[model samples]
Target: MTAVLATLNLGVERHGPWTSVGRSGIDKRPVDHRVQARTWGLEGDLIADKRVHGGPDKAVYAFAREDAVFWQEELGRDVGPGNFGENFSTTGLDVTGAEVGEQWAIGDAVFEVIRARKPCRVFAGFWDVPDLVKRFIAHGAPGAYLRTLQEGSVGAGDAIEVIRRPGHGVTIGYMLRALTTEPHLLPRFLDAPEMLPKHHEKARKWLAARELEKSNP
Candidate 1:
């Protein structure tokens, strides 16, 4: 399958009414030039909240244009690139279905899918939609968060080539569902070792709770 990077986005720091800290880096906009992709994130992108956003495990957030279109119809508005605070707006990419640990090569950088983008209050606040988080969870296409494996320059129109795909079947969609609405699917995350440690911890807790329930009942 052919996938392309439609746009490269960089966030700017802004004070917003809905943000807890009164400041957020959710207002990302498209950039024209090639930007440096570092271990933490794309250079020049503002990451205002380090507590939950921007880390080695969540370096680059990718959202597919196809997925955006789905939202556009539901929202009755143009869900354009960078509107979702994604660093990489992709076309012809099955980002939601991408397996955890799947490696994609774009420009000179290699990125490994690590987790799903969990919708937060900042996201809903950015869009000014009160129930967007709940609706996004219901939609279940939370997009993919990647960790940089090779730092290099990346630009819009870069061809995204899938270099590796783990057969574990733990996709961003499945993981998001497991993490959110479906507790039964949580144990399946164990098959994907490339998943973030926090998820594995959640899976363990779910299992322990289940075991306790079974013994007590």
Candidate 2:
């Protein structure tokens, strides 16, 4: 199957009740021209709340157009490109099903799949949906965050080529479910070392706690 980068989105600072730091970069919009993507993040993108967002581990965020359309139907509204604050809007790709450690080549850049997006209150507030966070978790298509392996220019309509995929079978969707609704699946993430360090630590802690509970009980 062929996959493509449907659009490149850049985030701008927005201030409102939806913002955690009194400002948020979740208000992303599509850009018509090519944009530079660096190891840090895409050029001209504003990232507020640095404590929890943005960095090398999450230099890029990708959301499949299919998933966006699913939400559009679910919400009865236009959940268009960049609406999810994704840096890359993808088409013909399984963004959530993509395995952790998967690498894709787009334009002249290479990005490695790192983790799944964690829905937050800001995301729910952005859509004015009170139960969006809970609903989003239930839907389990949280998209994927990427780490930039090579910096270069990227634009809309660029073809996406999967360069490498690890056999761990730990997908972005699974990771989200494991981290959220199904703690029983947490141990599976341990096999995918390509995952973000924080998640590995979380799984290890969970495993340790589980073992302790078994021994005590």
Pairs in clash, predicted candidate 1: none
> Which sections of candidate 1 miss by over 4 Å?
none
What TM-score does each of the candidates earn?
A: 0.97, 0.97
Q: How accurate is candidate 2 locally (lDDT)?
A: 0.91
* Model 2, residue pairs in steric clash: none
lDDT of predicted model 1: 0.92
Q: 89 in model 1: Cα distance from truth in Å?
A: 0.2
Cα error of candidate 1 at position 172, Å: 0.1
- The alpha-carbon lDDT assigned to residue 14 of candidate 2 equals 89
**Model 1: which ten-residue window has the lowest total lDDT?**
13-22
**lDDT of candidate 2 at residue 83, scale 0 to 100:** 90
Off by over 4 Å in 2: none
Against the true structure, whose lDDT is highest? 1
